[model samples]
Target: MGAFSLEGYKPFMAMVTMHSILAVMNLLAKAAFQQGFSSLVFVVYRQSIATLALLPALFFLRGRSGVAGMSVSLRGFCLIFLAALFGGTGNKILHFLGLNLGNASLVSALSNLVPSTTFVMAASVGLENVQLRSLITWAKISGTLVCVGGIMILTFYKGPRILNSSNPYLNLGTALDSVHYRWVLAVGCLLVSTSCWSLLLILQVPICKYVDPLPQALWLCLLSSLQTAPIVFFLEPNLSAWKINTVTELWACLFAGIFGSAVCFYLQSWCISVRGPVYCAMFMPLYTLITVVLAAITLHEELHIGSLIGAVAIIGGLYIVLWGKAEDSKRERNHIVDASEITISIDDKEDNITGQPLLVNSTR
Candidate 1:
């Protein structure tokens, strides 16, 4: 009935904050990779460190008794743990592997496809209501298509372009003359990683419905660490090599685990609870935009025209989806309000005819 209120504003602000933090986390991940850290080691260390950082907050906020008393059914715990496995471990592993093989700029650009994946999943799962007749919905679909098209451009259309000379960041393992087959494999990994991450959004909705956000996040991190530990220890088995190299790298890892993994996850869950999963999912491209801009500034990464166009399309599409959702919610609320007003009016008319008060008087 009313325009955007403080209640609406709060979730929007939270989403923006989450996007910014996630972008910084991406930069940190890139920086760590540039410093010669292996993708597997980076993910394991980052998650483990994040779990430790969360311990203090979990203790202080939840208290010793609350922590001890907190429990879920074994089945519920399993579901949550599996979600973390797919999202945190599986997604990160594929993403890192892809980044190792592909250009960070290209990987970052392609990551914008996450929202489209999420939207499709949400709609299929009945979490999002899609009105195909609406222009907003059409715009959203078009935008998503444009984003995909941009990715195709980046992947297929390669031409010599001016590189950013001022940027100290190297392209890492990415070489334009690299084997074409490797690029194909990397692109496949990126696609799989994006799909897994999108499914993470869908999985999270159910997990949050069953448990509190903070505990859900803590368990996810805990399970991710547990799942990764054996692989890192037994299969990889290079503890000494995993040690931090520089103070900056250590800080970057810590920040990724603490703020990026722990706090951001919690905030995202909270936002989804207040705003709905569809609304939160729509803001994902905003995070990509933040990543691109920060990569440009901090990593001195060159921007391609295709990336810019893709971003605009992604953002525009997300806006359409969000607008459609918001309008749908508005209409539903208005319908309720109108129904309430009619009921009240009918009661008032009855009271006037019967010569009795329509509303009950308070005793206190």
Candidate 2:
């Protein structure tokens, strides 16, 4: 493989790891909810446990020298805190709540919308430049629309075929019945969670610019855990119950904090740095697929044709967007090369006019 191919391998591997962690986290969240934990309580436990685990690791890795030299401006600290709040506390809370109230498979399918949201937001903020004339760009937009259409079909259109299904895997009655007013509230929470997650992806670029990925992740986990402490204390102060939970529940919380929060956060940052945010975001549907499979195995959740179609649409859209992005990157590289050649040519002409050595500083 070429250098570029090897360079690409790292982020792809990181993304694979990230998706597996997220899928496992979803399974654990489902298990926690099954144990009758509230979303607020679950998130608080996740953050606090992860924070405690990460602090020791951070200290061990950096020692005093690492702690002393590291500096974050007040504004930077605030930004990181806010990102943690929205991304960690807010996102996880809603996700847990949604899973408690809805089918995990359905929720995971809907969560596949993250890449489309990110693409739209990035384009709006001028972080991603869209070329409307390009077929690749159109493919991306069309694919996104198709994905959204599939979601709408699944959500709103229950025809005779859907209503009369006898297959155990086609059961949506419970999930559909849950869509009452209270369920709307759950959906709203899930929307907020999804939005916060997308925002975290955007904010992470700038944060990584200033701080090391691991420490930044550690601090975010710490601060989010601290932020949740008061809420968990006042709202669900039943520490005794948590203390006496089954070994499985304890393991779930530990895995969420360590593998899901600390390890995944660091890996995501590393992946984004290596692959750029677009590529990282594009692979999210892989996580969704993992979530579906795990939900089916662990939760015994039924799978429907709509779910399969929705997954395909989401993945297809992601590929289209990534194709456009790759084209944009290629164009950018070509533009840079052209500009460099122009500068060199102009310098050569000036040297010829001056009748002097070119002083090109050729190291070769």
What are the per-residue Cα lDDT tens digits for candidate 2 across 1-364?
6988978687888888888887888777767667765667767778877777777777788897556535787877878888888888778877777767665665676677777777777878988777888786786688678767756654543334322334333232224553443444555667677788888877776787667877788778888888877866787777764552666677778888888898888888777776677777777777877887787677766655655665576667667767777887898999989888843334566547787765766895
Q: Which residue pairs show collisions in model 2?
A: none
Q: Runs in model 2 with CA error above 4 Å?
A: 1-8, 131-137, 157-186, 233-244, 342-364
Please give the CA lDDT of all the candidate structures: 0.72, 0.72
Runs in model 1 deviating more than 4 A are 1-10, 130-141, 159-163, 166-176, 179-184, 233-235, 331-364
lDDT for 234 in candidate 2 is: 88
Give Cα distance to truth, residue 315, candidate 2, Å. 2.0
